[model samples]
Target: MQPVDLNPKRKKENPLVWIFEPLERDPEYSRERFFNFQAAYLDGLLYLAVASGEEPWNGLVVCTSHDRQAGLLEAFPVLAPHPVLGKWLYVSQRDPEFETVAHQMVKLARERDPRMGVVPGKRKRSPDVIEMKSSSRKKKSW
Candidate 1:
């Protein structure tokens, strides 16, 4: 979970730098590796993932649950089911509106779009207690 920046010197090495640069401009955003691919999060909720693998999955993966799938589908016609993260949607880089739609997605996340995020679970629960009770099994020992 590190904030990544598009290194101007290595811009040629990353084809998606242009798309990620604008997103990095926001203070609450960061890009990090998730599973085998990279994902971008806004205020701790993941909103997008970058996959440069095979077709269908090789693009921007919108972190969406089934609740808002319909609206997102209507907005981004090129979206499809992600092969890796089944719950999310994939927007192909080959789409003509890739850049435009990706930028819009960043903006939507910035606006705190209800349809754009999954609230992460809190990890502050009390510690579990382990009880060590003694059992009388010596008489049965063979």
Candidate 2:
């Protein structure tokens, strides 16, 4: 994982960026774990986007609180591309507007990226089978 550039002076700073640095520093942290979590999260978000035809990031809530919100917002701008996902990070700060924005974002993403909205078809099932048992004992040979 890359170091999160938290310098506010940078034109493209993201609020969530700070979390990356700390997560990276953890001794137990592993690339496989990180990627696994990232893929799962992204996949779920993508699934939601495809189902609702909306942008997944728009659903994020930044957790309202003067200090917390500011810190996160300053570090992770909604418009900035995510380091791992390479997509804009949406910030809501626990506001009700998050759902609306997220839904819209999903829609926009589907429109912009064809691959993002394509859901795979379900697999086919085998036909059911049944066997009949002899109701009566076979007639004694004549």
lDDT (C-alpha, whole model) for all candidates: 0.72, 0.33
Off by over 4 Å in 1: 1-14, 119-142
Q: In terms of lDDT, which candidate is strongest?
A: 1
Shift in Å, residue 83, candidate 1 = 3.9
- Flag regions of model 2 displaced more than 4 Å: 1-87, 113-142
For residues 78-103, could you state the per-residue lDDT of candidate 1 as single tens digits? 77667766778877888888878888
User: For all the candidates, what are their Cα RMSDs to the real structure?
Assistant: 10.5, 19.4
TM-score of 2: 0.23
lDDT of 2 at 104: 46
Error of 1 at 76 (Å): 2.0
Best by TM-score: 1
